[model samples]
Target chain A: MQQALQQKVQKAASAIAQECFAMRVRYLNRSLTSIYDEVFRPLSITASQVNMLVAIITQQTLSPSELGGILNIEKSTLSRNLDRMRKAGWVEIDSSQPGRSHTVQASEKGQALLLNILPLWQKAQETTCTLLGSERSKAIREVADHARSEIMKT
Target chain B: MQQALQQKVQKAASAIAQECFAMRVRYLNRSLTSIYDEVFRPLSITASQVNMLVAIITQQTLSPSELGGILNIEKSTLSRNLDRMRKAGWVEIDSSQPGRSHTVQASEKGQALLLNILPLWQKAQETTCTLLGSERSKAIREVADHARSEIMKT
Candidate 1:
């Protein structure tokens, strides 16, 4: 009986060590970010910067808070990154409302850069898909969508 | 000829705006972190901190750099997180090497905390799995491993 109880405790401990969704995601994020970053290096943009650009381009325009919601990024992180993008002339922020939230859009320069990097971006995407396989790539996207919606339900 | 080339460019631009590995992973990370963070809030530990504890417990002992590599975490991030873990009385640092690197291990309190939080952690894991589904949960782990190995190749 004591041995069985000890084995259960051992199993619990191991489970705590192994089944970590956050860590797994973070590691995946880091690895994929590195691969994309390398591809974007010549363009002097990080994978993160491109992500923001893509969000702005796809949405046409978004308030910082709205972008945060869609990206599942922290408000502060979104603001900070936007600042960098604005400095880089990749994003334009309209603060005409003063106290109200600001609108963000991809500047012409950002659009041009996105176009210029398309081939490289495609290569990176292809490599990532090849590495992860189509099944996992699709599953990751679907799971990301489902998990984000579940978290936002609160 | 010019118009046809422009059309192709436009399609490529749109593709870049839609499929992004880094963005997808970041959203997944943020969502999973939020879920795990909420569950571990009562214990005053974030999902990330628990993840570190798990690594330390499973490894028994590991140097800072080794742990960082194993976790696919950046060196600076690992250092910062370890500082917090050490302060929380959940991790111990052997700084015997003085100016050099140090070994880390989960403290006794950390072990007890792990046991205490096992049920809650399991709930968080199960909830995340249900939200993402079993197939996705397993696939994420596999993809993470594959991506990490790919990143480490160079």
Candidate 2:
């Protein structure tokens, strides 16, 4: 069965059309993410920054490589993002390691913003979940997880 | 049941941390998107642009608003994206609406590249579906459709 399936669907072009799997997810993500992004607009922070805030808050400090792994983003991209976060006073990076990675942490301002945005995030999350229904959302998420793991492994 | 679920399991923050339906989808998207993005790196296009390529492949000359709807993205974001696409010669936008909306279409170059990338995309997609199992990928995509419909109404 595996061999047959492999033979039948073994091209990126063929899968690109079937991107409906990813497209719907992308659409919903944009919708929900845009709302949170708007809410954090006044703070000059992006929803991505919020993810950074959460990570720093939980770990107190993490090296960029570790942060990249946890964030599942490329190190270069993470470095660039952290550069912006550091400039915004949302986080700090210790770049003493010219060749090696260093630790990163949220700033005082960043931590405060997290507390401030917690309720807003909660409200938005609650509303969307309610609309999605817990059972339905859970099932969708489970499938998404399986999909993510499968794609990442390859 | 909806109301009860909301009350019983309205765990948005925890969900984002522990398990959010969108995270896996978003993760898979980011991962899959990054692969294509990296593949097209020499062309200097991002995953989002490759995604727009898919949009152009699907429809006739589209206005920003039309692309926004099909992509489930906002017009403002679409505006910037279309501008980039136009500049890159990947798309051409015609003022079909006479000051209202513009029609968009892929260029010769874009079509050629699409055909060029087909083989690479095939390998990526095939590997992913195989990793996920054909039945699992198919089942998950069906559920994604349901979730997308649910979100569109929301």
Candidate 3:
């Protein structure tokens, strides 16, 4: 009887510790993002925005729907993010297509700015990868990717 | 020479793919958060704020510094998140001493509203866990925890 009770208690404690750790992960991501954003701030881009800009630049031209589809970002969030970038003169939004949203492409200035920021971004990425190690960092990215895919499909 | 060049190109491709996957993960998290925020919009709470509220409800009278520490959020980010929560009347601001900010507890209305919303939040959690499976879901959380600890030390 005592052994069974102890087993139950152990299970409860394990579950509690697990949940506690998960919350820590959220903060860790936020903190790391803070660091990247600080470094990228001089470039006049947010870490999230830099990711989006790099995507758009890679494609050269993409409709909002297409961009959202590729990035797994919501139509709304991408729209707002793109709007900010546009207003900042970093992207050109072509909204002339009837019954369809605008297609977005980075401006020449935007591309130049992105080129300047890429090396800095790489430095930030290297710091994180070095800290986390290649295997563990890749594993965390894989798990986060899988978990994110699961959530979006919901 | 040709074989070595091929291997170098393959390594570059793999590196790009890893960055792509990480960006996708970040985008999905942003989108999933938008959905959760929409669900709790009437309450004027963002998903992260809801998470903070849940943390506070679980632990009474946590200061902003202490709460920031627990959340793994930067002190500045926590301050900003707390500002909005305070404006929404979901959290109270106090001070233990000069120039120190203490976010003590939720308002009565905030407390009552959280009780009502808890079920909806739990439903989301249950559905996600069900979709991901217990083992994979647990692993995701564990990896997230590991990531958080890694960031904390860095």
Better of 2 and 3 by TM-score: 2
lDDT of 3 by residue, B63-120 (tens): 8787876667768878888888888888787765777665578666566666556555
Chain B TM-score, one value per candidate, order as shown:
0.86, 0.75, 0.75
RMSD per model, one decimal? 3.6, 8.1, 6.9
DockQ of 2: 0.21
The true-versus-predicted C-alpha distance at residue B65 of model 1, in Å, is: 2.3
CA lDDT scores, all candidates in order:
0.81, 0.65, 0.65
TM-scores, one per candidate: 0.85, 0.73, 0.72
- On the 0 to 100 scale, the lDDT of residue A53 in model 3 is 73
Each candidate's interface RMSD: 3.6, 7.2, 6.8
lDDT of 1 by residue, B14-122 (tens): 6765577767897787778888899899999998788778888778789999998787788999999999999989999999988887989887788778877788888
* Clash pairs for candidate 2: A11-B122, A12-B121, A12-B122, A12-B123, A13-B122, B61-B103, B61-B104, B62-B103, B62-B104
Runs in model 1 with CA error above 4 Å?
A1-10, A148-154, B1-13, B97-101, B148-154
Best by TM-score: 1
Cα lDDT of model 2 by residue, B1-154, tens digit: 2554333222333444555433454566666566555666766776677677777666645667767776677778888888988898988778756787677887767766676666655555566566566766675566556655765674
Task: Give the TM-score ranking, best first.
Answer: 1, 2, 3
